[model samples]
Target: MVNPGEVPTASVSDLPSQDLVLLDVREPDEWAAGHAPEAVHIPLGELPARAAELAELPDDKPLYVVCRSGGRSARAAMWLNAAGIADAINVAGGMKSWHTEGRPLVGDREGVPPEVL
Candidate 1:
């Protein structure tokens, strides 16, 4: 398990959801461009206000946080951990790695091929 800035992290290989929750903490445009098909989108800017909402998630499950790249997700993960969400982990390389490693992706529009933005 990768760890950065005292927070846990996941990799591209662990993506596409392996019976875990994937949170995409990217902006609306980035999320719209492409993201893990099963990810839960919650823009980083909104995390402060929405942190409480995540408390309802199952504690036994891991919550993998992701962004276009690892930057934002790392901070989000740190914030989440400080917020007492121990299972929150950042996806090391984010969607860039996922797409590069041939992982699945989905766009906001139907029938359109997803592309990382």
Candidate 2:
């Protein structure tokens, strides 16, 4: 469990079975390379401005935040939690871990297989 003031984190293997929102904070290029199929992209730098967008997402479920690695997502998760975006949880190890664990990933371009960038 995460202590107060600390962002909660979960590895790909430990993701909850319950439905939840996946938010990707990676850069546009990175996202184009590969990302969780259902994730909503809002690059980390744009999160503050796009805050209202996430408000439209369902709130009953937790939000899983991810980036190239854990660093950005951790900060994003913490900020979202403080900003009342949702009960944010950082996806530890980010896309690297997700790919290594064989979780589904898709790219923006067609006919080109996705890869963690």
Candidate 3:
């Protein structure tokens, strides 16, 4: 088990999606603005009550947490690790870097293509 507050991290550009589960901890509005199509949404504020929902995700796939930036996701990843999901990883720089790195995103928020909120 990882130490408290010692969640692992990964850069957006180097994220290996095939081996991980992308968990978006951003708020609904931010998520609606733009987010990775394959990511699973679970707002940080709701994590405490909704953590059980994560049990259904494949255990072999480590959870990679993300948000608009890296702050909230770090907290969420730490919480997840504490909750027994030992492999939860915080996606460094979050969606901002993902968008800046030209990663593919899926959302239809007017003329706003794919941008970090």
Off by over 4 Å in 3: 1-5, 17-19
Put down candidate 2 lDDT per residue, 1-117, tens digits, no spaces.
Answer: 334347888998988645758999999999999998889999999999999999988888889999998899998998898877788999999999999998888999788899999
lDDT of 3 by residue, 22-117 (tens): 899998888888889888898999998988888888887788999987888888888888778546889999999998888878875887776667
Best by TM-score: 2
Q: lDDT tens string, model 1, 23-91?
A: 899999888888887778889999988877787767788788988889999988888887676578889
Arrange candidates by TM-score, descending. Answer: 2, 3, 1
- TM-score result, candidate 3: 0.87
- In model 2, which runs have C-alpha deviations exceeding 4 angstroms? 1-5
Q: For model 3, what is the error of residue 84's alpha carbon versus the real structure, in angstroms, after optimal superposition? A: 0.7
Candidate 2 or 1, higher TM-score: 2
lDDT of 2 at 27: 98
Question: What's the TM-score of each model vs. the native?
Answer: 0.86, 0.91, 0.87
Clashes of each: 0, 0, 0
Cα error, candidate 3, residue 31 (Å): 0.4
Better model by lDDT, 1 or 2?
A: 2
Kindly report which residue pairs in candidate 2 clash with one another: none
Local distance difference test, per candidate?
0.83, 0.89, 0.84
